[model samples]
Target: MRTLIIIPAYNEEGSIAQVIGDIREHAPEVDIVVVNDGSKDRTEAIARDAGAEVITMPFNVGIGGGMQTGYLYAYQNGYDAAVQMDADGQHRAADLPKLLAAIPYSDLVIGSRYVEQTAYRSSATRRVGILFFSKLVSFVTRQRFTDTTSGFRAANRKVIALYANYYPSDYPEVESIVYLKRRGCRLAEVPVEMRSREAGRSSITPLKSVYYMLKVTLSVLMSASRVRVRGVKTSG
Candidate 1:
């Protein structure tokens, strides 16, 4: 498959080059595109220097908007599949093949940290939120998700087109799974090891994490209600 790795970056000048280099070293065959989400830093310049195609947003549109731009690029360029990875170096490039291998079985494949158990750890509050969302998503979609917030994922052309047309704007990862399920897209998860951020602090603080959980839960519930009422299955 013609796969494109989409890295959404915002003020990631510290780690963007290393992330791009790792992807190039590990997955040379696949194309790479870095969506610079209106970074005040030199993220776009560094990404360009790293030899990956760069798309600079005029303003910060958050992760979802940046990823949607990548999907649109993939769709317009006729890519058969696309994989999303972080620019902070948390996601491993070596795991790209595992995600791609699973693409033949499903429309979307998520790289999950809890699938086989590794050394991934988060705060207790965050863990509780993840557990709550996991069960809630399973209940709504009838598909269990071990890690709903994981940004490491691969998608087929159908999913690419869907996301290109419409995607959540903020805190989109968990809600996106539910959206795909509602649209009748097949989803699966594979075990992958995630490393700690090599540079920069996470944007999610304790207060933001609380808000994230509440907002995502509400968004998922609202989307599920609409799907049930419409009784419509979205097509590629």
Candidate 2:
């Protein structure tokens, strides 16, 4: 398959190059694209020097917009599949193949850290948020998901077109799964070990974490009842 790895970065210069290098070393057959979300640092330059295509947004559009940009690019450029990974080096490039391997059986495959429990660990606050969202989504979608907030995912052409047309504005990971499930898209999760961030810190602060929990909860509930949008046109 013509696979593209999409890394949405916001001032991730600290680890962008290393992330690109890891992808190239582990999944050289796939193409890479770095969505620089109006970063004020050298993220774009570093990603370019690392030999990945760069897509720069005018301003910080946040993860949702940046990710949608990558999916839209993949859809328009005739990529058969697309994988979403973090730019902060938490996600392992070695897991890319595992995600892609499951694409043939699923419309969207999520690389989860909690499917069978590996070395991945999180803070108490973050764990509560993750568990809450996971349970919320599993209840609404009638499918168990251990890592609903996981950004590490691979999507086939069908999901590519769907997301290109309509993606959530922010904190989209959890709600997106419910959105896809509501549309009858098949989803699967594979166990993957995630490393701690090599540089920089998480964007989520304490206050934002509270807001994230509430906002994402509402989004998931609403997404479950919303009608599926029409798929956008894609070229060969």
lDDT per residue (tens digit) for residues 1-236 in model 1: 89999999999898899998999888899999999999999999999999999999999999889999999999999999999999989999999988999999999999999999788887777788888988999899988898998999999998999899888999999888988888888999999999965333778887788788889999999777764324335332
- The TM-scores, one per candidate, come to 0.94, 0.95
How many backbone clashes are present in model 1? 0
Which residue pairs in model 2 clash with each other?
none
lDDT, each prediction: 0.90, 0.91
Where does candidate 2 stray beyond 4 Å? Answer: 198-200, 228-236
- Which candidate number has the best TM-score? 2
Candidate 2: Cα lDDT at 25: 96
lDDT tens string, model 2, 168-207? 9899999889988878789999999999654338789887
